[model samples]
Target: MDVRTDEIAEQIYRVSVFVPHAGGGAGFTFNHFLIAGDEPLLFHCGLRKMFPIVSGAIRAIMPTDRIRWLSFGHFEADECGSMNDWLAAAPHAEIMHGVMGCRISIADMADRAPRSLANGEVVDIGGKRIRYIDTPHVPHGWDAGVIYEEVTKTLFCGDLFARLGDGPALTESDIVEPAMIAEDFFNLTSLGPTTAPNIRGLAALKPKTLAIMHGSSFSGDAEGAIHSLADHFEARLRMALR
Candidate 1:
C-alpha cells in the first residue's frame, strides 16, 4: 500500500498506489488525478477501502477539504467508491458525472446532489475548463464517460488504455501493446457498434496527455494511440462475432 504522487501535467497531479502480486499476478496500480485550481477537482476516488491512502496523497498537494468537485467516469469501486467519504470530508464538494450516471446511480448513491453534465458540456473550475463526453459501453460501463481539459489538452479517460502491472508513472512510449494485453486479460471492451466511433471521438480531441485511471499516464501522440485502440477493438469485435 505504497501511495505516491507525481505531477503529470501542469497543476495536475497523479496519485498512485501500487500493489505487487495483486490478485496473484504481475501486480496493479490504482490511480487518481487531482487538478489543483481555485475549485480543485479529483477524478476517481479509488476503492472505498483505500480512501485514507487516496485522501492522504491529495492532502499532500492541497487540503482534502478544499476539493470542490468529485468526479468519475462511471459508477464503480475504483471510480466513485468513496463518493460519500469525499463529500463528508469536503463540506462543499459536489459530485460530477454524466447525465445517465446521475439518473442511474449518483442521484441515490451520493451524499449530496450531483451535477450531471451532458455530452459536450463544459464547466470551468478556476483556470481549467473540463468538458464531459458520453462514451457508453466503449470500455464496458453503459454509463461510461470521459472528461477533457481544454487548456491542457488532457483527457481524463477512465479505464481506456488501462494496462496491468506497475507501469511507469508517465510514459511517452507506446502503451498500446500493454493496454491490449490488459484488455485481453479483462475482456473489458464492449463490441457495441458505437465503440469505435466513440473512441474516434476522443481521438479527435488530440489529447496531449491521457490521465488514465490505471497504470501510467501517456504523454505523446494520444490521438494515434486512441485510433490504434479503436482499430484493435473493431478487429477483436469482428473476430468474436464471427
Candidate 2:
C-alpha cells in the first residue's frame, strides 16, 4: 500500500493512501493533511497500521520528529489511530482538539497530555494560524470538530466530504454529488436536525480549499459545494421525518 503526497495548497500537503476494495469493495481513499510551518501541524494520523507508511510519507517532506502539533476531527482510529505513535516520534508534539473531545475521550486516550481548544480558538503555528471549530455530531461522532487555516483559507474537512474511490489529489469540479453517493451507500452521517445547520455555518467561512479526509480534495466554489451538501442532508432529514 503506497501513499501519495500532493500540495493541495501553499504549504498544505495531502498524503493519501488508497484501498482498492474498501467499504464492501466500493474502493476508498484515506487522506491526511500536513501543514508545513515553524511548528508543523499534521491533521489526521491515519490508522495505527498505516503509521509506518504515513510517517514515511511525512518524513519525505520534513523530519517526522519535527511535527509539533497533532490534530484530527475525532477520536476514531482513522483519525487518531497513530496518536501515541506520533507522540513517541515527535517529542514536542501535542494533540489538540475541541474541549468536549478532550473531556470525553482524548484526555484518557492519548499517551501524552492533550490540549483542548475552545470553539473559535486560534493557534498560530508560525506560518499558519489554525482555528478549531466545534462540530459535534455534524457528520458523525460526538467528538467531531474541524480546523481552518486562516493563512490559506483551507478548511480541513474530516468526513464531511467523504466519498468512495481513489480520485485525483485535488479538483475544481463539483464534489457534493459524489459525497452524496457515498452518504447513501454508507449512511455514515448522524442525520440530526442540526446536521445541515452545522454544515451551513461552515459555509460562512468561505474556504478557498477543502482538505478532505477521504477521496479527493476540492478547490473552487468550496462554499457552494458545502451549501449544496448541506441542502442534500436537509432534504434527507425532511424525508426521514415525513
Candidate 3:
C-alpha cells in the first residue's frame, strides 16, 4: 500500500518550526526544532544531504552567533553524522549524549568529547526540561537513548519506529495516525525483531507522543502502541514457528 505524507504544523511553546523534510534521500530529513531558552536546543540534525535544510531551519530561529545545544537519540549521520559540520557552524553548540553514546562517539566512534547523560539526568535548558532515558539495543548500538521534553510533551525518539518515505513534519497523527504508524513500526521490527524487548523499555515513560527520529511520531497512546507492538512481535514469533 502507498502511504501519502503530510507536512502540517505542530505548534509547541510559542515556537515556529518546520514539520519534517520531504523524502528523496537516504534517511528522514527532519525539521529539527530550535527550542527557545537561555541556551537553545536542536533536535536530530537530518542526514548530511539534509544539512542545508537543517541549517536553514535553524537559522530562522537562532542567530549565527548564538550557541546551540546539539542532541540526538543515537549516533547516526541522520541523527548526528554531520556532528563535526554542525560543530563548525555553531561553535557554541555543545554536543551532548549519554554515557554509552559518549563512549561510542568519543572513545570509539567519533572520539569527540561529550557531556554524558544518565537515566533521569535532567538538564534544564534555560527553563525547559530535557530528561534522558536509557534505551539500549533497540537500535543495537552501545549508546542509545530517548529524550523527553517535559515542557512540550515530545519524546525525541531515535529509531524506535521509523519508516520509508517519511515527511519532514513531526507527530504520529498529523501525517499518519498511530494505527498506521504502529503498522509501519511492525514492518521495521520485521527487519530487526531483536529490538523487540527494548520496545517495552520505552513503556515506563507513558509518553503522549512517540517522537521517532525517522518516519512519523506516535502522538497518542504511546504505551498502547508499545503493547500493540509487543503483541505483534508475539504473533510474528508464533507464526514463524508454524
> What TM-score fits each model?
0.98, 0.99, 0.73
Question: By lDDT, highest first, what's the ranking?
Answer: 2, 1, 3
Q: Quote model 1's TM-score.
A: 0.98
lDDT of 3 by residue, 167-222 (tens): 43445443324334544534433324555566666677676766665555556777
lDDT of each structure? 0.89, 0.94, 0.60
Q: Which of candidates 1 and 2 reaches a greater lDDT? A: 2
In model 1, the worst 10-residue window by lDDT is 19-28
**Candidate 2: global Cα-lDDT?**
0.94
Model 3 stretches astray by more than 4 angstroms = 1-31, 107-112, 166-194, 237-242
Using alpha carbons, what is the TM-score of model 2?
0.99
Error of 3 at 69 (Å): 1.6
Better of 2 and 3 by lDDT: 2
State the local distance difference test value for candidate 1.
0.89
Clashing pairs in 1: none
Best candidate, lDDT: 2
Candidate 2, superposed: residue stretches over 4 Å from native? none
**Predicted candidate 2 versus true structure: per-residue lDDT over 1-242, tens digit per residue:** 54799999999999999988796787899999999989999999889999999999999999999999999999899999999999999999999999999999999989998999999999999989999999989789998999999999999999998999888999998799999999989899999899999999999999999999998999999999999999999999999999
Best-to-worst ranking by TM-score: 2, 1, 3
